[model samples]
Target chain A: MFFKIIVFIIIGIAGGFIGGMGMGGGTLLIPLLILFTQTDQHLAQAVNLIAFIPMSAVALIIHIRNKLVEFRHVLITALPAVTASVLASLLSKRVEGADLSLYFGIFLMCLGVYQLVSAIIALIKKKKSQEGKQSAENKRELSENRQD
Target chain B: MKKLLKKVVVVVCSAAVGFVNGFFGGGGGMLLVPLLEKVMKCPVKKSHATAIAIILPISIASAITYIINGYFDWTSVLSVSGGCIAGGAAGALLLKKLPTGIVAVAFALIMIGVGVKLTFF
Candidate 1:
């Protein structure tokens, strides 16, 4: 039991850290729990949701201190989101365990793909903008020499 | 009028985000970020930060439901949360040193693998 606690703590920390970073550690938490711990898929997801509350609260506090969050936005988003999430949670309960696992797996795969594609695209856009700046600078220097 | 319209848009987007997050057990940011960035015209940092805040209440809402439904494993929740708090703080410190792009890719790959395994095997 103690060993299990230790392992879970480690898992939580990792998940928390990733989640804190806004990378969605629960994304990792659900699968890892299901895979490594042989936990039921629904149980794993439940843990992820429950644990996310504190993790988000902590991160939200930090972001608040840093003035990263706007309360109006929070209110607009949280109010409805919470209501919908409750409904979703109830619906999730009705899903079969195997189907839940399958859906979660599919969700993770799609999320992963989205992350990779977006990162690569962001990198490309960054490079293009940098190149554009460089070329524009070269044009300005050339025009200045012509005026001289 | 414009302000009210934007607020309405935010509300609608947030509702969608809430549904997704609640349904999936978390992932609101995926949609929330884009909604704020593209639709609400929010700054990137603010969008991400607010998304986290938005998730807090939503998470609690779903979590309560899960709890009432007896879906939680207390030992697992306790152990993981203990680590998560500390890990979150630690991750921030290490963010720069870590290759975030690579990490994202790796995370994605793992997701696909595990997702496939769970779905079929």
Candidate 2:
């Protein structure tokens, strides 16, 4: 029992770290719980949902203090978000756990591919800009030689 | 008309975000940030901060539903949440020090690897 708690904590820490970095910790957490802790999909999802509450609440307070939260925009989304989430959560209960986990796996892969492609694009852009700068410098040097 | 269209788009997208978050039990914030930045033209920092504000209430609503459905597990929740709070602080601090680009790449690879494992094995 004690050992299990330790394992759960470790998984939570990993998930929290990723989440704290704004990389979607619950995505990682749900998988870890399912794989390592033998948690079923629905339960794992439940754990991730509940775990996020306090952490987000704390972060929200800080963001509020910093005036980072836009209340007007939040209001616009929050109503729809809450309504949809409640409907979806209830719907999740009807889905089989294995099917849900399988779907989640596909979703994770898509998200990963999206992130990877975007990161590679950003890197390529950076390299291209640097190369452009170097070429411009070379052109200037060549013109200077012609002038001389 | 354009303004009305944009509002409608935001509403539909927000609904999608809520549905994803609720169905998956997380990941809504990831989608929300982009919507805010690209569609709504919110600054990156503000989008991230506001994402939490938006996700918080949605998560609370989902959590309540999950609890009512008998998905609650006290022991795991207590231990995991405790670790999450502690690790979240550490992660926030690490974010300032770490090169985010590299971290993002690594995280993406990990996600792919895990996803494959879950799907096939």
Candidate 3:
């Protein structure tokens, strides 16, 4: 019980960090729920969504106050995704225990890789763009000197 | 007019996310979270929560779709959610005590492993 509580808090913060970063926190939360709590996958997902409710609310309030939320943009994903979540939730239920775990594990493992790869790719692209801008600026300065 | 375009973008993007989410129960969030974090540059912790918040509406919408399609499993949702809350609380607390570096490293390793698995297996 104590271990479980400790695990939950840790997962929350990690999930919160990921959540704050906007990766949906489920990737982190679901795995922790499975590994630490020994919950089944579908149940883990349900728990993941349930835990998300309050956490998300608090996060949303902060974003709203900071003017970080783009309401129009948010709706774009939320409406359809929510609809999909229900369907997925239903479908997930029919999967047997081991199969559910295998699928969830695969999903998590894949998602984690995607996050890291995407982050790295984004960083590289950003660096290249910065370099391009700097080179352009230098060329502009050189041309201006020649004109002078 | 500009707002409309933005709304269109949202709808399109959300729809894409929704489609993927509907197809695979996990994706709406996985995609949304990073897009929000990287593109929006939302602060990590806050963005994490916000992603979930954003997912809430999307999840509900998807849930409805699932229900309409006759896929929703209330018993499963209830059981999982019940377990998750308790687990989530514990996970949240455990995070505070660990060194950030350790957490980061562990997370990174997991991400790398998962990424490889996804790409190959």
Candidate with best TM-score: 2
Q: Compute the lDDT for candidate 2.
A: 0.92
Which segments of model 2 are wrong by more than 4 Å? A125-148
Q: Write the per-residue lDDT of candidate 3 for residues B1-121, one digit (tens) a residue.
A: 9767755665666566665554444456667756666655566655555565676676555444444544434443444444444544444555566443344445656755644443354
Ranking under DockQ, best-scoring first? 2, 1, 3
Candidate 3 chain B: 10-residue stretch with minimal lDDT: B71-80
The clash numbers for all candidates, in the given order, read 8, 0, 56
DockQ category of candidate 2: high
Model 2 lDDT, residue B13, Cα: 94
- Which pairs of residues collide in model 2? none
Predicted candidate 3 versus true structure: per-residue lDDT over A45-141, tens digit per residue: 5545555566556556765787656564465567665555555556655667567666656665666566556656656776899999999999999
Weakest lDDT window of 10 consecutive positions for candidate 3 chain A: A16-25
Ordered from best to worst TM-score, the candidate numbers read 2, 1, 3
lDDT (Cα, tens digit) per residue for candidate 2, span B9-88: 99999999999999999989988998999999999999999999999999999999999999989999999999999888
lDDT measured at residue B84 in model 2 versus the true structure, 0 to 100: 94
Q: Which pairs of residues clash in candidate 1, taking residues 3 or more apart in a chain or in different chains?
A: A12-B83, A12-B84, A13-B83, A13-B84, A17-B88, A81-B18, A85-B22, A105-B115
